[model samples]
Target: MESGRWDELERRVAALEAAAGRPAGPGEKDPTAPATFWALEGLRPQAQGSGAVVYAGTFRSEAGEVDWQYAHHVDDLLGAPDAVAGVDEGADRGDLAQVAARLAALGHPARLAILAAVLRGHDRTADLAELLNLGTSGQVYHHVKALTTAGWLRPAARGQVAVPAERVIPLLVAMGVSS
Candidate 1:
């Protein structure tokens, strides 16, 4: 890229950052920060300002082994406005610990499979055990306890377990089971 284009890109990113109310200093933190859209390599701003921005950019895989170019609207990229809105900036250590625990609960393959089974309507403990081919019901319940304690699963009426309604889409999206 030419110097002029690079400078323009930097200026635009700065403007976008400013408009989004991001703090200027490196160590400064904002409790209620808005979503930040990266102007990745080869990104071209299509339209900006007016409470929204559009860009043509490459979405790179984690390993940088693949890249897909697509035009993206910033709002759409951030997901549902209501979902992203009103986020508390004052999240403390306890909040972070809870998040870490929740993520850790999904780290095990058996736990992930169990969650997937529940998502697919296999809510019974015996059914989940059979689906995963575990040796005993105790093992299934152990994983179930982890998931339930992490707030991913809840006991339904009878002996079945379920993913809470509000968590269904978020969990599936996190697991890459849904877009």
Candidate 2:
């Protein structure tokens, strides 16, 4: 609203545009940005440093939409936009926590043995129960539920279960079946 405020915003936006390898001009599109980047029309820049501007806003695309975002110093968006890396700051840590919780579910020897058995194509719960000497379909089912909830196992079909594809590699690596 104030004169300095607009100037500050402009300076910040210019630095961000430069860092992102975009030429500065109102309505001039960023050539390096993703095809969907122009959807960032409402972006308002905020200066984070003397030569750095953080363009923070939402981006819309067919993949859906991302909100509360930032585009930082990057040479090109033709690659990946150089933004914050790793787990997003606002991501549901609940999912990350799920990994450890899943590991804990698999921590039991009986469960681990069952997962190994299932992963080996012994899809029948009864078959796994017999292999583990755990006895009965009910006991195996209980352990199976634990692994399933943790995403370590999934129902391959009715009356049959299997490990998820993503978990297969990790399971094999944990069991030393993979290199």
Off by over 4 Å in 2: 1-92, 176-179
How many residue pairs clash in model 2?
A: 0
Identify the leading candidate in terms of TM-score.
Answer: 1
For model 1, the superposed segments whose C-alpha errors exceed 4 Å read 1-91, 177-179
Candidate 1 has a TM-score of 0.49
Question: Number of clashing residue pairs in every model?
Answer: 1, 0
**Per-residue lDDT of model 1, residues 19-82, tens digit only:** 8887657886665664354553234345443234322222222223222233445544454444
**Each candidate's TM vs. the true structure?**
0.49, 0.45
For residue 106, give model 1's deviation from the true position in Å: 0.3
Global CA lDDT computed for model 2: 0.64
Clashes of 1: 1
> lDDT of candidate 1?
0.69
